[model samples]
Every structure is written in C-alpha cells, then in structure tokens.
Target: MPKVVLLFTGKRKSGKDYVVSKLKEMLKPEDCSIIRLSAPLKKQYSIEHNLDYDRLLDSSPYKEAHRLQMIQWGERKRESDPGYFCRLATEEEDKPVWLVSDCRRLSDVEYFKSHCSTGPAHPSCVLVRVSASDEVRRSRGWGWVGGVDDGPSECALDEVSCDYHVINNGIDEQLDMKLKELKNFIEYNNNG
Candidate 1:
C-alpha cells in the first residue's frame, strides 16, 4: 500500500520534474520513488508511432516537434483507458512514498486517490501543482505548442484545486521553505 502519495500536475517546463527530483533527494532513506506517468505512455506511443523512445523522453527540439502528435495519440489512448499510464507507472513501485511526477489530468489524480487512500476524511494522497510563469518557463526553453498547450491532456487540471501549489521560479527561500515543509509532511505521514 502507498503510505503517502503526491499527485503532481503542471504545464510544460513548470519545474515539475526538477521539484520531484528535489523531493527525491529530501525524502532520503524513507523509500520514496518518483513515478513519471508519461514514461510508460511515451514508450507505448513511441512503439506504436515508430518514434525513438529516447528522443521522445528528452527535453529536446525533437520532443517539442512531436509533442502535438503525441498529445493527440495520447488523448486517443486516454479516452479508451484513462488510468492506463497511471497503473503502468506504479506497477513496480514498492516504496512507501510515491510521487507521481507527471499527472496531466483529473483522471490521473482520481486514479491514485482511489488506489492510495482508504477514505476521504483521512486522505493519504496529496495533489500538488508546481507552476512557473510563462516568462520563467520560456527562459527555461518552454515554447507553447498549439494543440498540446491548449488541449485536455495539458490543461485538464489547470483550474482544479491542489493541496499545495508551488511556484518554482528559481528555488528561492520561499520555495525552499515550502519544500522543507512538504518533506516533513511526507516523512510524518509515511512513518506515522
């Protein structure tokens, strides 16, 4: 069973990956594992589309070029199975703390919520949104794609409420403080 689950959702180049990496470093010796939901989806998408999985996984011009097409393909798969990638990502996760680092839709969070938490009153799963400004993301090499930036896969959880909203512009003191508190939260809940 998942002792503590953090469902993370964010836009492209929103420091979601970077923040999760920090969480991994901070959750030390506590059996924390980061699950990128897109990994399995991208692998399947790459196989079916005859694309290079390695290239698709990287943050390169190659990935940006194929982002729209992949989003379309992913939407088709998600329509058929919303929880497909979620389940695949967590299949081998044996750790007590799970950080789902790339949740793109409401369904993704809902899937983990159902699987991780026993009841609503004593919820074990936490939804976290890591966001960086468009200017900041652009500085970090993020350019908007038409279909992908505007589509359901990327925009589905934008308006939803999250337990924690982290603004990761430059890992300033405020962001560091929040992360510290989050680490404490995870450790307390994971071993309590």
Candidate 2:
C-alpha cells in the first residue's frame, strides 16, 4: 500500500492534470507516481474500436470526437464492476505516494478508500477537487459538448465533499501555495 493516495477530480480543461503534474514535480520522482484511470479505459476502447490508443490519450480533436462514446463504454464496464478501472490503474503502482490524476466517480473514491486507505501502512485517502470557472476552461480550449459535458463521468463528483479544493484560474502564486500545503500534508501523513 502507498503511504498516501491523492485522488483528484475536475471538469475538462480544469487543470487537474496540470496541477497533479506540478505536484508530482514537487515530490521526489521515485517516491511518487501519477496514475490515470482513463489510460486503461482508453486503451481498451482503442483496442475494441480499432482506433489509435495513443491518440485517444491526448487532449486533441481525435479524443474529443470519441469522448462521449468512450464515456458510455466506460460506464457500462463500471456498471458491471465499479472498481474495474480503479484496480487496473493501481495494480502495478508501488510508489509510496500515488497521485490519481483523474478520479471521475464516487465509486473511484470508494475503491481507493476501501482498498488502499486501510491498514497501518497507509494514511487515509485524500480527495482533491481541482476547479476553474467555465470561462477559464473555455479560454483553455474547453467548449461544452452536450453528452460529454453533461454526462455522469463529468458530473458524478460535483457535490462530493473533498479533502482539498484547488482553484486553478491561472494564478501561479495561489496555485503554488495550495500545492505546497498539499505537499506538506502528504509528507506529514507519510512520516506519521
């Protein structure tokens, strides 16, 4: 089990990936790992659809074109097994600190809390919500898509309480401070 598991959730273009990347940099590379749940999902989708798995992982038009369908496919898999993707994401993670860069549902949180957050070896799971105004996201190339934006994958955790709330609106100083606080929290928990 990891010493700390940081589960992050946010809307598209809300900088969840960016913030997690920065957080990873703050910690020693060998001690931390960024786990994306979508990677496995996309890989499976790509294989079944005969699409390019690498292209589906990026934030490009190719990914956007298949986003809704991919979400639906993932949802169906989750319906049968809620922890399907969660298990795949963390199966091989051995780092003491796990930064789950994209946690889209309550099931994802439950999976980590139930599986990884238990025992004396690890601290409780931390849920961090990275958020930005729609305007800011739009400026970052996010445009509302009907089924994709309004779907469960995007809205499942909208009202879920989080351990930390990060407002990423292009304010470097503020973001840095929050991230530092988070890094400190992780260190404290790990050492305790």
Candidate 3:
C-alpha cells in the first residue's frame, strides 16, 4: 500500500498533469507512481468505438475530437458504479506513493478517502485542487465546451474543500512555493 495517495482535481487545462509531473520529479521516482483515472475510460471507449487508444491518451486533436463523447460515456459508467474507474486505476498499484493525476468529482475523492482509510497499510489520502484562470487555461488550449466545461465532471468539486490548492497560472515563483508546500506535506506524512 502507498504511504500517501495524492488525489488531484482540476479543470481540463489547469495544469494538474504538469503539477503532478513536477511532484514526481521532487519525489523518488521508484517509490511513486502516477495514475490517471482516464486511462481505463479511454481504453474502454477506444475498444467500444474502434478508436486508437494511444491517440486518445495524448493531448492531441484526436483526443479533443472525442473528449465530449468520452466524458458522456464515463459519466454513464460512473452513474452505475461510482468507484468503477477508481478501482480500475489502483487495482494493480503497489507503489509507496501514488499521484492520482486526475480526479474530477466528489465521488472520486470519496472513493479514495474511504478505501484508503481502513487497511492496516492504509495511506493518508490528500485532496489537492489545481486551478488556473480562464485566460490561462484558454491560452493552454482550453475552450469552453457546453456539455463538458459546464458539466458535472468539471463543476462537481467547485465548492468542495481540499487539503491543498495550487494556483498554476504560469508564475514560476508562486507555483514553486505551492508545490514545495505540498512536497513537504507528503514528506511529513510519509515520515510520520
């Protein structure tokens, strides 16, 4: 079991991936693993739709074209089982530290918190929110999509409390400070 599970949530282009990557760099790579909840969703979506799964995983036009449909499909799956994707993402995980790169809903947070709270090797589950201005996200290729940006997956955690919040608007100093704090928290938990 992991010593810590960082459950991250953010808008589409809010730099969740970037921040997670930075965190990974700050930690020992062999002791940590990055988990994307979207991986299983995209894999299933690809098989069902006969699309290339690899393409769907990339930040490319192919992914953009299918993003809405994929989101809808994932929502349906989540409705039937809130922890389906969460379970899939961590089913084979054995790392000491897990950086869950994308957590979109309150259900996702609950799933991790509940599961990580009980075992003998239970880890400290930390909820982290990453945010960027509309202008910054737009500059990073985030355009407002009706059913996507305005959907529950994007807005569900808007009012949710988080243990840590990262404002990633491309300011180096500010981002570094937030990330350093998060790193220190993780280290403290791991050592405690």
Of the candidates shown, which would achieve the greatest lDDT relative to the real structure?
A: 2
| Candidate 1 lDDT tens digits, 67-91 | 8888888888889998988888889
What digit string (tens of lDDT, one per residue) describes model 3 on residues 100-179?
Answer: 99999988999988877544453489889999999999999889889999998899998898879999999989999998
Model 2 Cα shift for residue 81 (angstroms): 0.7
Query: Which stretch of 10 consecutive residues in model 2 shows the poorest summed lDDT?
Result: 115-124
Between prediction 1 and prediction 3, the one with superior TM-score is 1
Predicted structure 3, TM vs. truth: 0.95
Score each candidate by Cα lDDT. 0.87, 0.93, 0.90
* Model 3 poorest 10 in a row by lDDT: 114-123
Off by over 4 Å in 3: 118-123
Candidate 2, position 98, lDDT? 92
- Name the runs in model 2 displaced over 4 angstroms: 119-123
Stretches of candidate 1 off by over 4 Å are none
Judged by whole-model lDDT over C-alpha atoms, candidate 3 comes out at 0.90
TM-score of 1: 0.96
